[model samples]
Target: MQKHSSAIWTGSLKDGGGSLTSQSGVLSATPYTFATRFEGQNGTNPEELIGAAHAGCYAMFLSALMSGAGVVPDRIEATSTISLDPTTEGSPTVTAAHLDVTVKAPTDEAAIRDFAEKAKAGCPISKLLKAEVSLALKIA
Candidate 1:
């Protein structure tokens, strides 16, 4: 089996910071642009991580579902938004995840919807999250 890699940095509790670096021994600074990374104390935070995980997981799940259903999607684009709400203890937790998925395929509406629902449940990241996740799927 092959393993992927990422790096993080930290300091104190409130004054800490981190960055994820690509390091499969490939030695590159890709995915480290200011837009994709670099965060302040109150910027570029955990919700972004959750969104990334959700989008990736959902895309993979949809691909698998399409393949299993004898339909090959020409394109699958999924955007996931994660909302955070504060707990009673004043800590922020993910409250919800919303996925907008657009898929191009030659499948019927019912099959598309069934695959969308299955993908939502079968995504590993979706299973890991405690947040309420919803999806809007558009198939054409």
Candidate 2:
């Protein structure tokens, strides 16, 4: 399935502003600006959206792996921390995606960790990102 989102930007790079809209309308006309992206101003940024996608995909994939392994999980929460740092080319690049995952189930912790590691490496977003990805799994 192909998904899509578009952005409309105006003005120069530093002073320009844009609105991001998703095909699903979940991010209907979300505002973003240079200040919001680099200065931590009030608005959504691409990195935040990427982090959300990574977390959501990883969690869902892990849950599916659990179900496929006959270990239905009670809960699986994945939080992604994306690091955007300047590269040698003077452009901001995604350097890492760290996932702090918490799982609640009666299954073996080793099994959960195994599935979580798989999800961390096999998620579509994870595969798309060339940055370093790390997973920290906690069982509850």
Candidate 3:
């Protein structure tokens, strides 16, 4: 399966603005701009979107891994923090992604840790990103 999203930008980098749309229509003409991205304005940005995607992918992958191991999870919460370095040579670079995860499960902590590590390394988003991926997991 394939997924797609589009962005349209107009004007210079500092003065320009753009809108993003996804094929699913979930993000139809969502606004993003220099202020939103670099100035912390009230709008969406690419790093925020990447964080959402990474968190969602990690949660789902962890659940699947636990299920495959015959342990059903009660709950899994994942938060991804994407670090962007604007001082990079040509353009800003995403330096790393840190995942903070909390899991409530019927299994032991050791099993949960094993599955989480596997998911962290094996998730599609994790593999797709070139940045260093690190995880901090808590079993509750």
Candidate 4:
């Protein structure tokens, strides 16, 4: 059960460009550049892709967790905000990820919170990220 993605970058870092391709062609040759990553360009970036993946993965994981806990969620949405910031020594790094999650279920607040926390901990994408991650859960 191993998957892989590849990236090809040409030229220098600041002015270079790259394309990423995943095992599935759904993400083939996705373009990315310095401006797209650091600046607010209307192009794709690794961090943004990571955020999307994290959000989707967390949502699905939460759904399963809720079902396994004898609770079914009517709706589950997770947003992952990945922050890239400069380190103490001025090196750029992925500082943190803040997950904002909302769930609709016929469950107690305590159970919802517990399930949300467990989902955040058990999500594969969350496990892959080494940065600090925080979860905010809302039940309705």
Which candidate number maximizes lDDT? 3
Write the residue-wise lDDT of candidate 2 on 74-132 in tens digits.
99888999999955487787888999999998788888889888888899899989657
Model 4 poorest 10 in a row by lDDT:
131-140
TM-score of each: 0.68, 0.89, 0.91, 0.87
Clashing pairs in 2: none
Relative to the true structure, how large is the alpha-carbon lDDT of every model?
Answer: 0.73, 0.89, 0.95, 0.90
* Steric overlap count per candidate: 0, 0, 0, 0
Q: Report lDDT (Cα) of residue 129, candidate 4.
A: 95
Candidate 2: stretches off by over 4 Å:
131-140
**What is the Cα-based lDDT of residue 28 in candidate 1?**
38
TM-score of 1: 0.68
Instruction: Write down the lDDT that model 2 would get.
Output: 0.89
Model 4 segments more than 4 A misplaced: 87-90, 131-140
What digit string (tens of lDDT, one per residue) describes model 1 on residues 1-140?
A: 54445645556544554565444544332233232333333445457767987999999899998998799988889999987664436666667899999888898888888899999988988887954757687785
lDDT of 4 by residue, 1-140 (tens): 98878898999998889999999888889999999998899899988989999999999999999999789899998899999884547678888888999899999889999999998999999998955757687785
Q: Could you give me the TM-score of model 2 versus the true structure? A: 0.89
Quote the lDDT for 62 in model 2: 89
lDDT of 1: 0.73
